[model samples]
Target: MQIDPRGPRFAAVLTSAVLAASLITDSGVLLAVQALVFALGAAGRSPYSLLFRAVVRPRLAPPAELEDARPPRFAQCVGLAFALFGLLGHLTGTAWLALAATGLALAAAFLNAAFDYCLGCEFYLLLHRARPRPGT
Candidate 1:
């Protein structure tokens, strides 16, 4: 089975570390960092694109045309929102909720890696197709 090249491996790493640390202590800082990572990716930071390019090309070998849809803008938004929800759960001391959200995100990434269907990305493309473009 082909895996998705753009799986959230890095984000998963960061989330894992943050979740570990969040367990032993109370630190808004860790949650903030997690949210920031998602925000950066959502904002189209170059590093995110570089990471995507690096992973997708040699590792997954998705068609070159996928670059035009790099990160799938709407998927990035969903990711950012999910991360933010996790952060909010942390701030509010909702441990189970926070963990559930984080776990869901991680599981989704793993599924994408294994099965090549990015659920969030599909939503992104749907949104992209439903909207009217500029000057159209």
Candidate 2:
């Protein structure tokens, strides 16, 4: 399925906010919440994305183009992976590791928010390129 290109960036803003708050507060629960959000996004049911579609998207002009969902979904999986690590590290008493992981997630979110640079999408593209094509 295709999606408005703005949708993922909008979601990234929300994700970055959550990540930044978790990093600043050192809140395991918050990180877990973000993990849940990431899981939802990976599943294509993200609350932020839903809200964007239902609320914000309706107010804006229609997008000029749409993009494939796979890249963004893959990106969400990457986010989920980081969040799981952060949560696990925090729960296991490895605060440094947790911070490191959360910080990494935060950096990625920030990139998406500030520049619309999707590392996850880039990674997805790289993987897609590396895989053998069906007819090749």
Candidate number of the best TM-score: 2
Q: What's the TM for model 2?
A: 0.97
How well is each residue in 24-120 modelled by candidate 1, as lDDT tens digits?
A: 4655566566567666766665254566557654676554432334544455566667767777787788977677666665555554555655677
Against the true structure, candidate 1 reaches a TM-score of 0.61
Q: Write the per-residue lDDT of candidate 2 for residues 1-136, one digit (tens) a residue.
A: 9999999999999999999999999999999999999999999999999999999999999999999999999999999999999998998999998999999998998899899999999999999999998998
The lowest-lDDT stretch of 10 consecutive residues in candidate 1 is 1-10
For candidate 2, which ten residues in a row score worst on lDDT? 105-114
Off by over 4 Å in 1: 1-31, 46-48, 51-64, 131-136
- All candidates: CA RMSD (Å): 5.5, 0.9
Over 4 Å off in model 2, which ranges? none
